[model samples]
Target: MCFGPFKRVCHWGPLVALGIIKAITFSTVTCLSQWWPPQQSASGTLVFVAFSSSAVLTLYFFLQAMFTGPGVLPAGWRPEVEGDTRYLQYQKH
Candidate 1:
């Protein structure tokens, strides 16, 4: 369980798992780079691959969060009662 910006409950397990995976991937890349000759082009390629992979993962997580339904609302929640529906906006559509 996680509390979002507005104190709404959210299932953040997947996000946490993604973060861990990202960290592990980065560490593995760093280790692999250390095994390669620093002056070699392969070393540069490894670095680029590491960064690109991280970037792709970041984008994937961003899209996943953006597309996931709104987080859990409080018990007996109602947008009209909350009175913020008029000001609410979604960038995607």
Candidate 2:
């Protein structure tokens, strides 16, 4: 998929994985809600809390992955010269 603002291209694999994760989370929450005690006054609150927490965690991880830099190049790797920067092809703005 294309991110319009960033002008970046993202592959479909991550999107598919995210959809699968959301589906699993919803299924789990549904199961939990059904298994919760019917007599309890807090069943709805419990499910809400569970779902919210899951969403929050997922967002946290997504942000973390987005913000983290790609990491350094291999050890001892260096360009031939200052004017020769062909190796630095993926510099971010």
Candidate 3:
């Protein structure tokens, strides 16, 4: 994916996720009774800002992780020795 709104994704996972997110957002907006018939937009503006910010941030991180590799894992999670089945045992969920 490119770093832009018109970014293209080779795989379908992120695209599906993005579509789901948008659908949920629109559904939420429509389900809110106060969303329409707004006497004043100040409160609505605040709500919109809060919600849009959350969505944007979520999308940002989602795309970031998808495009960039999932970054690095912390050290010590992997056993240094080969065939180290010991570390795999007793992992606390």
Every candidate's lDDT: 0.64, 0.67, 0.68
Judged by lDDT against the true structure, how good is candidate 1?
0.64
**Per-candidate TM vs. native?**
0.38, 0.50, 0.55
Top candidate when judged by TM-score against the true structure: 3
- Among these predictions, the greatest lDDT belongs to 3
The clash count for each model shown is 0, 0, 0
lDDT of 2 by residue, 1-93 (tens): 456533221556656766777888878767766777434658766766867797779867875675566688885576879677765666556
Candidates 2 and 3, the one with greater lDDT: 3
Whole-model alpha-carbon lDDT for candidate 2: 0.67
- Give the per-residue lDDT of model 3 (tens digit) for 1-93: 465543546457777988998898777666543653234666776676677788788878877776675355565667778688565645365
Q: TM-score of predicted model 2?
A: 0.50
- Choose 1 or 2, whichever is better by TM-score: 2
Residue range 26-50, candidate 1, lDDT tens digits:
7866776676534677767767677
Q: Quick one: RMSD of model 1?
A: 10.9
Lowest summed-lDDT stretch of 10 residues in model 3? Answer: 30-39
Candidate 1 lDDT score at position 35: 68
